[model samples]
Target: MTNSPTPDQPRVIATDAALAFLAEIREDHPDILFHQSGGCCDGSTPMCYPASEYRVGETDVKLGEIGGVPFYISGSQYAVWAHTQLIIDVVPGRGGMFSLDNGRERRFLTRSRLFDGGEACPLPLARG
Candidate 1:
């Protein structure tokens, strides 16, 4: 795994709030893995997957475990995220459903909903 960020940079601050959120997911799916990617914004959003079935892209990366859960960073995105940290939180959403937070100023990542004969989860937020 990459080194932790300097004191001035954003470091993965795993607070009780964040740990509680992770615990909820762990209880629901103990085998899930957490990962982050790069695209628009500060970087990309956190993505969860079934650990047993998770696939890594063809890139060199450092794998680290946080809160006893496996986490991965893509080789290409590592440098950009070196000074970034991720925190988890739940926010109120429409219909009383909660949206996930990555502790950044940006709310979440947005992606295309189109798929090939298969369903994909829509992003929690909309993009311009």
Candidate 2:
């Protein structure tokens, strides 16, 4: 998931710190993925879980990969976030209750930047 930046490319990315934290988590949980639910309880934060744990429904869309993990968002949320790139970073805090990062003292945070005028459109939304 380490693609060079070039116009609307690589819709999702993780910072060095984020990558390190992800690696740490991966050591314990080999296959994990992330989902940013638009629900109220989580405050729109990205939640990390084992890939087999959370069931991706038909309404969710795969945004892209970050830190070699697949990232997804509800289609409703995707409609609103489609124009921006999701920058996943690590912040000092407890992660979501059901997320893998919960007890790690550092959680995955999302930051975004809008796409440029000449960039290509995002990939086709996939059915979960």
Candidate 3:
């Protein structure tokens, strides 16, 4: 299930081009996942990995699904980005170093817009 802001607004969504690219990647790795990087360098890019190779942390926040794949952000990062909606789009450049899309000429980019009053996603990330 996708995590939408305020129960109805999507927290993250993919552009048509990005969705097409995701389809290409899905052909190879049927089960894929995405984690928005919050590191000091190159953190804007969304890193994708096969479901078998990566692990979702207990503190990670599931922003939502883009192109039918789960997208997550770290709890700390989510705290800083709570007022915005993550827009997953395609850009011409290298993807995250370890991401499945590394070699592809196109990469998944994160663009965000701040939520207006009453539009912010305040859902507490459920943890085990």
TM-score list, all predictions: 0.53, 0.88, 0.92
Each prediction's whole-model lDDT (CA): 0.46, 0.83, 0.86
Task: In candidate 1, list every pair of residues with a backbone clash.
Answer: none
* Model 1 error, position 60 (Å): 4.5
Order the candidates by TM-score, highest first — what do you get? 3, 2, 1
Q: How many backbone clashes does candidate 1 have?
A: 0
Off by over 4 Å in 2: 1-8
> Order of all candidates by lDDT, from best down to worst?
3, 2, 1
Which candidate leads in TM-score? Answer: 3
RMSD (Cα, Å) for all candidates, in order, is 14.0, 3.9, 3.9
Q: Write the per-residue lDDT of candidate 3 for residues 1-128, one digit (tens) a residue.
A: 33334577888888899899999999999999999999898678899999889889999988888888999899999889888888889989888889988988888889988887676647688532
Q: How many backbone clashes does candidate 3 have?
A: 1
How many residue pairs clash (N, CA or C atoms closer than 3 angstroms) in each of the candidate models, in the order given?
0, 0, 1
The residue-by-residue lDDT of candidate 1 on 1-128, one tens digit each, is 33332333323334465466667666767776655646464343556566767676656353445577665667656554443345533333211112223332223231212222322222211111
Q: Candidate 3 regions off by >4 Å?
A: 1-5
